[model samples]
Target: MLGQERSRSFTATAILFLLPAVAFYVVYMLLPIPMSFYYSLFKWDGISPTKVYSGLSNWDEMLHDTIFWGALRNNIVLVVLSILIQLPIGLILGVLLTSRIRFVKLFKTVYFIPMLLSSVAIGLLWKYIYDPTFGLLNSFLRLIGLQHLTTGWLGDPATALFSVIGTICWQYIPFYMILFMAAIVGIPDELYEAAKIDGASDLGCFRHVTLPLLRGTISMASILSLVGSLKYFDLIYVMTEGGPNHSTELMATYMYKKAFHSFEMGYGSAVAVAMFAISLIAAVAVMGVTQYDARAL
Candidate 1:
């Protein structure tokens, strides 16, 4: 009975220690979610003293909104590109940096510079670079007798989405690279030495040893990239404003338009709820797929 009392006392102390954090989460994160769901069922202009109960009408409208679907498709495209392009390139850069290359520190710093800059700053800088007439890209093309190749990159609907995607990749690849570099650093040199003694080439060592060890980090980076892509807003918003004909529109931008610009608070809340739902679903899906990959490895 004395030991049981002590155990109960320890549990009480632990709960006391956790109380503040739990309270903060309840107030900030947990409360807002259900509130958002509640708001989604009403038609309110956000400033009106009254809210009209709209039931499932907002959600039903969203189902038929073609623009919303387009934005969703764009978000999916971003997720795919992030997985296929950014992750592989990041892994390659991490491997190269960890190798015995000269000027390793310099290379690392240069590679990481993009990740350090503010997203808004990077977006503005690239906007100038993609300028059609006087932009750096067009100017360079004209200088090299490739004037015909120079076009309005951000203005053209065909190129606007991809142009924004490229910028996103440039800004985020370094983040994954850093994650990979840290993981690579944790690996033991003794393993590589053993592989070498066994007459394994560098490629063989990487394929058989390094890849397996980095599986956990790879899974983490993939999930981060997936979720980040889904909620991607700032850079694309600043760069394109979903521009040139909704070509670069993303789900987040669409939500902003509905809530703030259009003053459809209820509809916007519905969009927010959907956005949250999609993000959660995608995250769970990625976790499951990566878990499977981990098991297979």
Candidate 2:
């Protein structure tokens, strides 16, 4: 009888601990997600006094909308580029900093500053850097007698999308850097010492010891980067706004355009749904990959 009373007390305490957080989530994030679903069935400007229900009509239009596809393709590009470029570079930098390299703190801080800055600030900063007219990049290229390498990075259609991608990658690299650095630092020094006693070269030690142990951390980083890229909007929207012929339109940007710019609230909701679906798919894929790799190890 006493034990049963104690169990009840424990359960009540746990409920008390969880209630505030659950309430906050439901009030803020969770409720809004379902609200989007309900709003998706109605055709009305957000300010309209009358909402006309058009079940599945908006989704049907979205299925054939070319712009949605472009945005989705751009998102896919960001996702691929993020994983391919950011992950390896951040991992390598993390490994170097965590090693017996000189002035590790200084280097880590320098790399992390970009991440600490606002995304808007980073976007504006990169815009000037990529400017063709009297910009630092062009000036440096001319100084080095590589003047032909200069191009209007954010303006040229051929390069605009890539330029935005680069900015996103640059701003985000430090986050992955810090994540990898933490994982690498948590590894015991004895592992490296044992590898050295076995006469393992630096590369061999990294491959054998560092990579395997860092698997969990890498998986986590990959998931974050993938999800962030899937829903990416701020940098691209600020820098290009899908300009130079919509070369950089991402799914989130497209949703914004439909919702506010075009005043098609229902269709915008549909786009939002699609964006949600795409993000969910990408997240699931990364999870699957991480699980498979973890099991193989």
Candidate 3:
């Protein structure tokens, strides 16, 4: 009876400790999701208390909106490029840093510096770097006598999306690098030694042992990349405001424009809800595929 009482007391203390965080999450996160879903079914300018029931009209409109589709496509482009380019680069860098490389600490710090900067700041910095008139990029091109290649990067529709994506990769690659590095460091050295004893080359050990061990971290990084790409807003907003004819507009930026700029709160809520659905779907799909792959392996 005494032992049972002590167990109950411990359980009560644990619940008491968790209550504050759970309350905050319910107040700020959980409640807002349902509220957004409810708002999505109404037509309101946000100022009027009268919410006209529109049913699925907002969703219907979003489905037909070409601009919204374009923004979504741009988001997908970011996700694809991040998975293909960013992850590989980060993985390579992580491997190199973990190997018998010189100045490992210095290299890690330098690589991680970009991730420390605010997205807005990084956007502004890259904006200047890509500037056509008297910008570093154009100036360098001119110096190298490639003046023909120098054009307004951000202002040009052909290059705006790619330029912004490059900035996004630069800002985020370090994050994946650090993530991968941590996972790589945690791997048992005994595995590597065993591979070496079996006459496995460096590449062989990495291909067979390291890559398999890092599968979980890779899946995590992939999910994070996908979700973040879908909701990407700050840097793009600060850099272009989805400008140059909406070439770089993301779903989040479009939602903001509808909600605050255009005063279409209901429409914005619908977009937000749609984004939430898409994020959940993408995360689940990626996780499912990774799990299947792991099982197959």
Candidate 4:
């Protein structure tokens, strides 16, 4: 009877400790989802005194919206490119940093400098670099007698999306690099020592030992990159505002324009909800696949 009473007391204390976090999650995360969905079913300007029930009109309009589809396509491209570019480069950098290289500390600091800056700051800095007239990129191109290659990077529709993507990759590569470095640090050195005893080359050790062990980390990084790419906005917004014929438009940027800029709150809410749904689905799919792979292994 005394033990039962103590168990009850302990459970009560645990509940008390968890209540705040549960409440926060409900208020900030859970509540907003349903609220956004509710708002999406209406035609409100967000400043109006009345909300007209549109009943899925916004979703219908979104389905037929060309720009919405384009933005989604851009997001998909970003996800693919982010995974393809960031992971390999980050992995290489991680390996290099972990090796017995000179100036290792200095190189790590220099590589991580971009991650230290605010997204808006990076955006503005890159915008200046990509400037057409007297900008670093164009000036260098002219100096190299590649004058034909010098064009407005952000202002040209053809290059705007790619230029913005390159900047996004540059800013985020360091984050993945750090992640990979930490994962690499956690790897058991004994495994490498064993491989060496078996006459394994450095490349062979990496291919057989490192790659297989880092699968989980790679999977997690892929999911992070996927979700982040889907919801990306700030840097692109600061740099181009989805300009140059809407070539650089992302779902987040488009949603912001509709809600705040165009004052189409309902449509914006629909877009936001759609983004949430897509992200949730993609995350779940990746997680499931990773779990299946783990089980197989």
Global lDDT scores for all candidate models = 0.92, 0.88, 0.92, 0.94
Best by lDDT: 4
Q: lDDT tens digits, residues 1-297, model 4?
A: 569889999999999999999999999999999999999999999997999999999999999999999999989988999999989999999889998889999999999999989999999999999999968999999999999999999999999998999899999999988998999899899999999999999899989988899998998899899989999999999999998878999999999999999899999999999999999999999889999988888
Candidate 2 residue 147 C-alpha distance from true site, Å: 1.4
Candidate 2 segments whose C-alpha is farther than 4 A from its true place: 1-20
Clashes of each: 0, 0, 0, 0
> What TM-score do all the candidates reach, one by one?
0.90, 0.90, 0.90, 0.92
- Would you give me the overall lDDT of model 3? 0.92
List the candidate 3 regions with Cα displacement exceeding 4 Å: 1-18, 188-205
Model 2 Cα lDDT, one tens digit per residue, 1-297: 569889999999999999999999899988878788888999989997999999999888888988788888888888889989999999999999988978888897788899878878888888898889968888899999998899998889889999888888899888888899989999998999999999999999999999989989988987998888888888887888778788888888888988899898888888887788777887888789889988897
Q: Of the candidates numbered 1 and 4, which has the greater TM-score value?
A: 4
Q: Lowest-lDDT window of 10 residues in candidate 4?
A: 1-10
Highest TM-score against the true fold, candidate = 4
What lDDT does model 2 reach? 0.88
- Give the per-residue lDDT of model 3 (tens digit) for 1-297: 569889999999999999999999999999999999999999999998799999999999999999999999999998999888899999999999999978999998899999888998998998999989968999999999999999899999899999999999999999999899999999999999999999999999999899999988988898889888988999999999998999988999999999999999999999999999999999889889988987876
State residue 98's C-alpha deviation in candidate 1, in Å.
0.8
